[model samples]
Target chain A: MIELTINNIKVKAEEGMTILEAAKTVGISVPTLCHLKDLNPTGACRICVVEVEGFKNLIPSCAYPVSEGMVVDTNSNRVRRSRKTIVELLVENHPQDCLICVRNKNCELQDLSERYSVREHRFAGESKNHAIDISSASLERDPAKCILCGRCVRICNEVQKVGAIDFVNRGFSSIVTTPYNKGLNVSDCILCGQCIIVCPTAALREKSSLKIVTNTLASKTKYAVVQIAPAVRASLGEEYNMPAGTDVTGKLVSGLRRLGFKKVFDTNFAADLTIMEEATELIHRVQKNENLPLFTSCCPGWVKYAEGKHPEILDNISTCKSPHEMEGAVLKSYYARKMGLKPEDIFVVSIMPCTVKKYESARSELSKDSIPDVDAVITTRELVRLFNMAGVDFTDLPDDEFDNPLGESTGAAAIFGTSGGVMEAALRSAVFLITGKNSDNIEYTEIRGNRDIKESTLKIGDLELNVAVVNGIGNVETMIKKINSGEKKYHFIEVMACPGGCINGGGQPIHQKTENVIKRVKALYEIDRLATSRRSHENEAVKTIYKEYFEEPGSHLAHEILHTEYFDRSR
Target chain B: MNTNVLEKFPQNDRSALIPLLQEIQENYGYLPEEVLQQAADHVGMPLCTVYGVATFYNQFRLIPLGENVIRVCRGTACHVKSSANILFALETALNIKAGQTTRDKLFSLEVVSCIGACSIAPVISVNDEYFGRLAVKDIDKIVKKYSARKVSVSTANENQES
Candidate 1:
């Protein structure tokens, strides 16, 4: 322990803790832009600079280590002046059109400027007029608005291990962008959008599909259908100032109706469908001993990562498309046929807690004859914005149930929002199908949590099933190596690109507290626990779809729509 | 993108990024995308990260340089003495934008952060020959002199030995 006097308050700080962390214990918060928690501090932004009693220069509290008997003045007049000056310089180089920006109310830089009372720029100079990269299906990168905080670079490169963007060039010309600034579409970007979440300003944002959705809904010729992902319902309420873990599923269904959408479908129905198809595929593979471990292809980010980086294991991945994609395909095909509407006339929009879904929806492989499965994908944040634009009060909205045929789902489908939720959901149904009896245990707590990688061997009936759950795409390489090297054996493997699965997805609301995200993860489990049907096979809608249309899971018709192929994009 | 340069480094080592990039830049004059990908493959680093390091230093270039690279300084001293006009004149004379190569690959104009010759305000160095106290009127003559002469591509350090 190190004794330090922070702002004249005598306090004891943990040894090796940064001055910023130490100061926080004493009710002092040093503002930081580039200092991401748990990641290595770049100290690129000097906003967190603090004055030491003896030192002449203000030290970056985020990077500087706490020393014994150190006297720190976090909010001294000199420190305030320096911090204010830094904000002024940043603003001088930054765009002043914050009123019209996407992150107008929820920006870290804007908050810092407000706290420091920075109204005018003192040293206005030449700002870089780099072109915005809108080529990416997922995100738009506006270099003009970037403050060069390197938060996006750190999160994408360090945390996600994608390294899609970085601090390119030097000094004034420094901008976070993909290789050679040749646009993100052609680059090795997985389009996971982890960078968009970490970005402090409106420099990075989702390529909005709200305009297309609104136009499609208003069109007389177009029969617009909307579907919401499992994770979205848990996180969407956060955008409306509601507490996290608050199940806005009822309100969300009601809000979509208010947005002039008559047909509102839950992606959870398709999640149950995914479980059926995936479990069947896994069983077939296990029985034949061909592709012993079936990798989950539910996350397009993970699928793209495998395609681009590990093409050798492409065959190991399940052919099933993600839940929303399956829903879109069903909406265009079966739903369209039932309603006597052409696939072209019906526009399917998916509300997802992911930006990668935007990329996935636009995939050529998922499309047949140039018509994509899902037409447009709007993020949870974008949905909140849509509701706001339509003058819909989310809080006062009456609870409404999802539309029938594609609305009803099982509790297992609801749990598909979390990290090991897919593996658990699949196992719950797989065990029942294999044994022809209900197992007392439904929850596979062994494979749960936000661990980078989790592995477990569970006794299901007579077979001991070895399964691995990769919570994030970044933690996949080690497990992939284990599988490839024959060092480890597994019957099933589930991977989601974003940490903690879609519940903490990149397209979710910008959370000021991580507890909110944790609450979202728990809310999914709570939804799973307090449901009538807890298994995928028990979902009446899924059973009906299988009986009426697709014959059964893994049938020819099911494979045609539910399954997709992978390509070697290893550039 | 040549294989000979990449095979020299040990594979899967992140520490070899800087030296490997430096060697690649030295061998190929500029860091090509294909070669950068290969280098990243060799070091087990992402191509974007390799690109970031390569671009962080002005010493490295993504695009190939022309026959003669004209560097116009934009240091504090140079900027104060109307270096923007000097750069503009060079761009007009070369018929290319700053930080761009001429259509014929004869000249590549670049505005350097600094030339370190602050005493000689607003300086433009062509290859090795330093032209201090540069004026906008002298830009055409300088461009013509370089274009007319037989092209010789060399750095300022190699031939500018006093």
Candidate 2:
């Protein structure tokens, strides 16, 4: 540990810690824009500039390393002027439509402008007039609103490892785009929406399906059914001023119920079903020698990426549709039959921590009874808007459970929100199926963290099954490259496009720190461990669905409703 | 590089033109398609369109290239500084155009999109060992080094055969 004085306060910090980090440790607030923890600090935005005793110029505290006996002034006149200048310059070309912007209240730029009292820009330069690109099914990119902090580029390339977008052109005319300025829809973009989540401005946003959802809710002729994802429980509270990781599951269900939906369900129920199908499929594949090294198909972003970039490996991907999409299909088919209603009369809505599900729901192949599986898809943030629209006090609502058989889920289902949750859930069922016995060991702690890449092996019956989990696309690239080169071997692989799984998904309430993301992820795991049923097969609702409707696991009817196909996409 | 030659070439043929151009460039060090008419006959296209595609994109080579490919990144970030100097050095060294190869087939130069290392500006990757923070003075030393290494390898192979 090294001792230092920050803003006249003496502090002890770890050696090699940046002055900004030290300041943060001592509760000395320093403003920053382009500084995200666990990500490379580029010092592109000079807002965090602070005066050190020895340095002539105000140095960026974010990138400047703290030395022994360092004296720092966080809010001196020089520091203030520099910080204000940076904020003013950022606001100069920035779109002044803060009132109507999607990120109006939640914008960091807006907060900084208010903090620095930057009412008007002195150097209002000519703003770049570029058209918004909304061609992608999952995201919209407005180059005009881009501050060029390159957060999206860093998230997409450095964090996710999907180099789909790069700084194209030069200087004032420069823009972030894929090769040849091709539309993101046409490029090799896996619709993860991490870029949108990290973006400080409204330059990047999820493709809004709010209109479709609102239309369905407003329609009297059709009955709309909604399912909230597990990770959503830990995050939905953030939109309502509740702290991050607050399990607002019951309140979320109640809010959805108040929105006039015919039935409020949990995707955890389908996530339970996914485990059953996926685990059974994995065992079957191990026995059959047909597409060894089965890949989990839960993340739509990973699935699209596999289809677009690695079409040769399509056979390796599990045929199972994501839990949300599976629930939609099941609702349209089984639930519609039970209600004695036509599939068209029922509108299935899925609230997910993903933007790719927007694209997944609209796929031509996902339709079962001549109607699309999921009629509409909305993010957790969009759900907050719906709650507000209904005039429901999210905090005041009594905790309520989801309705009936479709609402039943296990702890395993709940954990599926986090990064390694899917792999761990699969292991629970896979171990049982292989041994034909319920083992006391349920938690596969090997794959249970927020690491970008995690690997483990478990002994089941006579075979030692090797498994690996990858959270981000960039990590997926390294794993895939190794797999392609025959450098690493694994029987089963779980790839979640968003880091820390669906719990920290792009559509989840945006929290900036890895520690906060891990906290939310841990809350998900804790919820899972404390729940009664820890395995998907143990869920009575899932068991009932299989026994009453589908007859058995991997049955023809089950396959038809729960599974889908993949297509090779051009790069 | 000549628009008139490309205009005279047929537009419909794609497959035959690529290989034909490759062969022509291999033999004469440039796509002298006037020496080879079989590609036009095989593809059932007039000669003009074939040359048009070859000259249209930066990927294709209508003229003879140097033996080594010296790709300088003219990407937005790289172009900001020192890149012009690097380009000027290459032009002076080879006495050839940006797209053209040396008469001795010693070097070929072209520009590319970003190489994904923005932190290290003014970079050039030769067969992908990105050299960053380059200076104009470093160009001659680097070029001479590659040339010397190539000569030594060829000599070693000759001695091994003997």
Candidate 3:
């Protein structure tokens, strides 16, 4: 431990802890813009400058280590002046369009400017004006708003391992961009959107479908239907004053209904359907001994990454459409047939905790007759914006249930929002399919939590099942290497592109603290615990859908709608 | 297409990136996007980082190089000697601004900070050969000589091709 006097408050901090972190322990909040938690510090942004007694110049507290008997004043006149100067310089170059920015009140820069009480720009210079890039359907990049914090660049290159974008050029001409400033669509971006979440300003954001959904709702000729993903339910409450992981599924339904949606449905229902088809497929693959390790295709980001970076393993990925895609297909086909409406007349909008789903919805494979299965994909953040824009009293709204047959789901489906959830959900039913009875133990506790890679082996009656789960795309390379080297063998693998699964998805509310993600994960687990039917096979609506329409889980009709193919997009 | 430039560097060795990029710039005059991507792949670095490093160093250029390059020094000594006027004079003569190449690719202009020959104030280096103690009137003479040389070089290339 190291001793430090921060603002005359003597404290002992752990060795190697930065002055910013030590100050944080003592509740001395030093504002920072470029320090990503657990990632290597860049200290590019000099916002957290502090006055150390021995140091000649104001040191960046975030990058400076706390030393024994170090005298530090975080908000001293000298430090405050330096920090304010930094903010002034950043603001001078930045655009003055914060009111119309997507990140408005939630922006870190705005918060810092307000904290520092920076009312006037002292350093006036020629501001940079760059064209806003809306080339990718999933994300938007406004280079003019970027403060050159390099947070997004680091996240993309280091954490996500995509390297889709980077800081190009030097000095005044420096900007974060793809190679040659080309559109992101041409780059190897998986569209996971981790960069958007890390962005301190409105520079990086998901391309919003809020306006389109509003137009669709207002259109008299179109019947707009919306489906909410499981992760959306787990984290949507954070947008409001409600605490993180406060499952507002019922309130979310009420809010969406107030948004003027014709019908509200749950993607969890399709998650159950995914389990039915995927479990049966796994059973067949296990018996036939073909495609030994079947990789889950639920995450569109992971799917795109696999296709582009590792096309050799494309065949190993499950052919089933993602839950939301499956829901859209079923809504267009089965639900449309039941409602006596043409597929073209019904517009489907999915409220997803994913930005990649926007790109996935536009893919040609997930469409029929040139009509996309999902017409629009709005993120959980966009849903909050819609709620706020429509003046919906989300907190006061009564708990409302989801509509009809497509809304009903099981506890196994509810757990699909977190890491290792798909595998656990599938195993609950896969064990039943192989042994004609549910597993005595339902919770696959071995494969739970935020671990990057998780694997477990179990004996289901006569068959030994081997399964693995990968949450972040960065953790996938090692697993693929093991599979190729014949060192690790598995019959099934579940991969969620975002770390800690969909609850911490890129499209969810931005959280700097890890506790919010944990709470969201716990909330999904709580839903599973409280649910009546804990297995996908036990979902009566799913069973009815199979018996009355598809005939069987992997029947020809089910394959036509639920199953999809992948392509080799390796560069 | 000259992947052989990357062959000297060990695969996945990030330390080899600077040397490899230096060699690329030495061989190709400017780093091409395709070659930069290949260097990124060979060095196991992100393409953006490769571009970042290349741009951070003023020695590297992204666009195609012209036949004759003119680098105007804007060092303290040169600035004191009114190098800005000489830069403007050159820009007018070449019909291009600093950090740009002429449409005919005969000459390119770049304003640099110190080429380490401060003894010769207001130095202008054309293709690594330094000319010192020059005035605004000297810009036209220098540009005309480079233009004349470019014509002869092209004529020789045309003769060889025929």
Candidate 4:
């Protein structure tokens, strides 16, 4: 431990802790923009400059280590002046379109400008005026708004291990861009959107589906059908200033209904539907001893990652489309049939807590006869904007249930929001399928939490199933290496591209604190705990859908509608 | 498509990325897009990252150098002597930026630090010939002289000299 005096308050800090972190311990919050938690510090932005007694220069507190008996002034005249100057310089170069910016209120740089009282521009710096990258269907990159903080670059290269973009050129000429500054569509970008979540400005965001969704909703000829993902309910409440982990599913349903949707369904019902087909597929793979390790194909980000970097494992991936895709296919097929509407007449909008779903919904494999299974995908963040645009008072909105049989789901479906959830959900029924009885133990505590990789073996009936859950795409290389070296073996694996699973997906609310992600994960489990039925096989709606349209799980009709194929996109 | 540049290097070694790129540049004179992708596959790194590293350094070029290459010295000595004007004069004469090649592939202009010729401040070298202590007015005549010469690759000139 080291004793330091920050702002005349004597504080004890652990060795190797930065002055910014030490100050944080004593409630002296030093604002920072480029310091990503648990990642290596670059000190790219010098906003957290502090006055150290012995130092002649105002040191960046986030990069400076706290020493014993070190005297520091975080908000001294010199420190405040330097920090304010930094904000002014950044703001001067930045575009003055905050009112129309996607990250106006939630932007870190904007908050800093407000905190430093930067009412007027002091420096007339030139804007880079970089062309915005709207090449990808999922993400948009407006480099004009970038502060050169390196958050998005770091997240893309280091955290996600997808070096789609990097710091190109040198010094004042430096810009974060893809190879040759080509469109992200032609680059190595998996479009997971982890960069969007870490970006401090409006530089990175999802491509707007708002205009299309709104136009489609107002269309009298085309029926606008919407589905809400399980994670959106777990995290969207934070947008309304509600406490994190608060389940706003009912209010979310109410808000969507008020948004003029003809019918609002739950993606969880499809999540349940997914489990039935996936579990059967896994059982068959296990029984046949072909494609021994069936990788879960629920995460489109991971699916795309596998398609690019590890195409060898593509066949091992389950052919089941993601839950929302399943819901769309079912809605377009059976639901449309029952409602006496043609597939072309139904415009499916999925409110997903994912950015890759936008790209996933456009996959040609998921479409039939040029009609996409899902028409437009709006993120959880965009849905908040949509509600605000429509003047829906979300807080005061009465709790309302989701529409019809498609909205009903099981407890297993609710847990699909967090890491290790899909595996656990699949196991609850896989055990029943193999043993003709439900497993008394529902929660596989060994594979839970935010660990990058969690693997466990369980005895189900006479078979010992080896399963693994991968939380983030960055940690996947370890699994890939182990599997290739024949050192580790598993019967099944569940992977979510973003850490902590869909609750912390790239399309969710812009939350920087890790606690908020934990809260979201816990909220999903709470929903599962309070649910009446805990197994996917027990979902009456799923059973009804199978009886009404598809004959059964893994049937010919189920394969045609619910399952899809992958392609080798390796560069 | 010849890849003898990587024959001696160990396969699947990411540490060899720079050495591999240097070898490719030595052979091809400029990094080709297809070869860089092959290098990425060999080194187990992403193609974009390889492109990033290739571009981060000033030594590597994605396109071939022109037949007439001009290097304007912007070192500590030359910069004080107003080499900026010389570079701007050259850009105007050549119709290209300092780091870009001409649209006709006849002239390429680049700024260099020093070429052991600081004795002559504000110096520029065009195709292995140096012009020292030159004013901005001298650029048009030098450009005309290079344009009248026969079309020859800069690599062929270097090869013949070596």
Per-residue C-alpha lDDT of model 3 across residues A194-239, encoded as one tens digit per residue: 8888899989999998888899999998989999999998888887
lDDT of 4 by residue, A229-322 (tens): 9999989989989999999999988888899998989999999999999999999999999996899999999999999878888999999999
Q: Would you list the C-alpha lDDT of every candidate in the order shown?
A: 0.88, 0.81, 0.90, 0.90
Q: In candidate 1, which residue pairs get closer than 3 Å at backbone N, Cα or C atoms, i.e. clash? A: none
TM-score of chain A of 4: 0.99
- What DockQ does predicted model 1 obtain? 0.69
| Residue lDDT tens for model 2, A1-571 | 8888987899898888899999998788898888887777899878899999978888988998888888889999888878888888878888889988988888888888888899776995798888898988888989888887888888876777666776765567677766545578876678889988888889988888888888888998999999988888887877777766788888888888888898999899999999999999998998886786899999999999888778999999999999998898888888888879888988999999888888888898999656998888889877777777779999999988899879999999998888888999999898887887887888888898767789998888788888999977778768877687886567899998887788778887765666667767877977987898888889999988888899977899999889999998833
> Any residue pairs clashing in model 3, and if so which?
none
TM-score of each: 0.93, 0.78, 0.96, 0.96
**In candidate 2 chain A, what residue range of length 10 has the lowest lDDT sum?**
A173-182
lDDT of 1 by residue, A1-571 (tens): 8898999999898889999999888788889988888888878789999999889888999999999999998888999999999888888888889889999989988898899998676896897788889998998989998988888887787778887887777877787888878888888788887787888898999999988999988899887888999999888877777888889999999999999886999999999999999999998998899987899999999999999888998999999999999998998888888888888887888999999999999889888678899999999899989999999999999999999899999999998889999999999999888988878899889888878998888787678889999988888887888887997678899999998899888898985567888999988999999999999999998888888899988999999999999999986
- Native contacts retained by candidate 1: 0.88
Off by over 4 Å in 1: B69-89, B96-100, B109-139, B149-162
Tens digits of per-residue lDDT for model 4 on B68-157? 899999998998999999999888877789888988788888889997798898899998999998899998999988987644555678
Error of 3 at B108 (Å): 2.1
* lDDT per residue as tens, model 3, B106-139: 7889989998888888899999789999899888
Ranking, lDDT, top scorer first: 4, 3, 1, 2
> DockQ for all models, in order?
0.69, 0.03, 0.73, 0.61
